[model samples]
Target: MSCIPLTQKSSDFLISSLSQVNPFNDTSSIIKWIEYKNNQRFEVNKIPLSKIENWYFEETTGNLRHQSGKFFSIEGIRVETNAGPIKQWSQPIINQPEIGVLGILTKKFNGILYFLMQAKMEPGNINKVQLSPTVQATKSNYSRVHKGKVTKYLEYFLDKSKSWVLLDQLQSEQGGRFLRKRNRNIIIEVPSNEDVPVYEDYCWLTLGQIKNLLQYDNIVNMDTRTVISCIYYNCNGNDRYDIDRVNECIHYSPLIEDSPSGYYLDILKSAMKKDEGLSGMDDIRSWSTNLKTKYYLDVNSIPLREVEKWRHDEFNIYHEDGTFFRVIGASIDTDKREVGSWCQPLIEQIESGVVGFITKKINGILHFLVQAKVEPGNFDILEMAPTVQCITGSYKNEKPENQPKYLDLFLNPDQSVVRYHALQSEEGGRFYKEQNDYWIIEAGDEFPVEQPENFVWMTLGQITEFVKHNNYVNVEARSLISCIGLI
Candidate 1:
């Protein structure tokens, strides 16, 4: 199969976005299947970091590592930045330099695209099971470094001969916990006639079904949300790509009869109106570049033993205040994963967080408030973050002026302005039962158009365009964007 044109891909997404029915399973059945998968035999027990098997701390640096030195490790880093109130700090961060792959497989059935989603289990999941990408694997797992079962359908992502790539980009993860971490977020489409075997724990659902599931909390995993956020629905001027013709193809079709109406319809309009944004794409890029050039970030890897203000005990490594997070060990036993059982280190958040976006209409088009945040682990030192991204518990005693910008708006929001709100989890494979209060609050008419120096206004269309590349948008923003309700 040849590569699908961008215009056709956008049209196909619009059709699928409007469709809720498919040949395979419905939304109710998918939820029930996830409940069943949660019941499957799996056990995860907290263990002492010193008791984990095949793992040891280096004598000189006190850095934790696997025996084979293949997987990730927990090390210490000292960060110095001029963006925040605190000038310097030391903490333990996950050092996983290898790039992982988070991919979704799609096939057209009855002229509507159906996505292949997996009911996968991760050791750190709070619900035990959630809908994930078709292929979510690290380099060590796919390469069989642990000598386990093969990752099913990984070949389609590895070899270009197996499928045609629809969307591909290198996206970053949590900069606070992971140091310079990124994954390949991609989507591919197979030939409609190809006989692709669907596993028992996996099913085919329309994009509309997936979006419907997003309305519910913790049903779709982080990997799935980040990949789906990369899906584009807009078409700018190009000799090769055309949006008008594509819109005309499915303009008046019955598929859109059940489409979203009130606020959701406004979201679709905001995504389609690329030119009506408050700031042009060029200006946003220039602002980002200016922030990158203006900010100062200096990070240095050091021995875990040398990290100040953090205590390392036999069981775990944590801070004196016990606010941010800690590193610990977990013994996992399960028959559903690639490996039957294993022991590894995991990062556990000690406090609940708030990740939100404040939106308002600019020139009659919905625009999202974004921040150019600088973190020590970011590859480019600056990425577009949500309006208010911070651990609420960490700022309880902080002064109002010192807190994150626009955080008070979500804390004391009016019931009428709350567009979308839910409790979402981070990647369960790494984080241990970590979750955040994800929100999208529509600013009232009285909200001002002017923002701070580090902030800017952008539309969903503009945000996704930046997401198509690397390190431009943070994972927190992408996770909230995936929860956008279209139907």
Candidate 2:
């Protein structure tokens, strides 16, 4: 068979046709066609220019071009050999005595014409030349070398319009398909008859076809991350490791070792049973062990304290004096005590109990000016009135007065003047006037005059009003005494 020279048009046409035929479909038929067409060639070597020339000369001269070429002629006479005329009469003469034959070969088959030319060669010498395959099949087969057998089988299935369900019945026989469980890709493992190892002789099918085969095998859960992790640790660690890639490989095959040791492993082991003859548990365990040793050993060993120290100095929690220092929020300090907006003195005073404000809401407006003492505790207790009555306005000025308002009762529990009036006077601005010293304009004077041990005194007018408003005499009088000057 002769080599067919490819033109740009023909090459484009062939590629387009091949593209239209889905490589994923019916790989078997394609492979069969390749084998059939390849058999027509005498040798597997790619066609060279010399072979084409020889073929062309042979067809034109009615002899293989080499057989009719020139021999060593003496003087001007043509030399004759045991074969016949050493040189064809039609050939042009040259000055060199050992000049070889130059001819062409032409052939026609099924209305297609082919041509080739041979260069000068020594007469009586058998020329060796590389021949390109005339048919497209040989080139296509060569292109599929890396794809492996599983991919080829998958392509066969796809070509036949078969679905993935059919792959279940196709048992992986000797020198048959191999599934890359981690990648969800198929590889063919063909046996070798030569001295070479079995794995080396295996021919690969197309990648697209292998993917189709995986679909048939229901091997869709491949994750890139786990696969990459497996490859990185088990294969060579050449690729960069990242979270996303690791997660992907985990999604598919369980061959990956860096995955969590849990129910996921059990599921993977069960699924792996389908390809039972390929690899054993020991092989997988060893691979996983290697991966762990390479990528994950340090994750569980490093101490938190060491890591923190390495990154930065320790975060101090105590002041120089051993008092606990806390990070107080700016918003809390500003809203609760306007001390935050003032200079350092105001802030220090608030902290030191020299000056403080009670947070209270009046008519739905939050006011932070009410004077109060901050109790020393985990929580600052705002002492407004002694029993915590809501007060109005900023008490910045009144805090220095030291007048015993309602709140003073708690501070000085033994004080005798309980019914003292906190009145805003026309002259003194505000003062606590004892009721006994004021006019006793009582509706009835029979009220007990003896001072109760824990009681604050009330005026006769206040007692009569208390009776008018309350249901019980003792309860109303006591309640009124509690807020004696709060208003």
TM for every model, in the order presented, reads 0.97, 0.12
Per-residue C-alpha lDDT of model 1 across residues 353-459, encoded as one tens digit per residue? 99999999888778999999888889998999999999898887888888898888888789788988888889998898888888999987899999888999998
For residues 315-371, write the lDDT of model 2, one tens digit per residue. 211123222111111111121111222110000001110111111222222111211
Residue 156 in model 1: lDDT:
85
lDDT computed for candidate 2: 0.20
Give candidate 2 misplaced runs (Cα > 4 Å): 1-25, 42-206, 210-487
lDDT of each: 0.87, 0.20
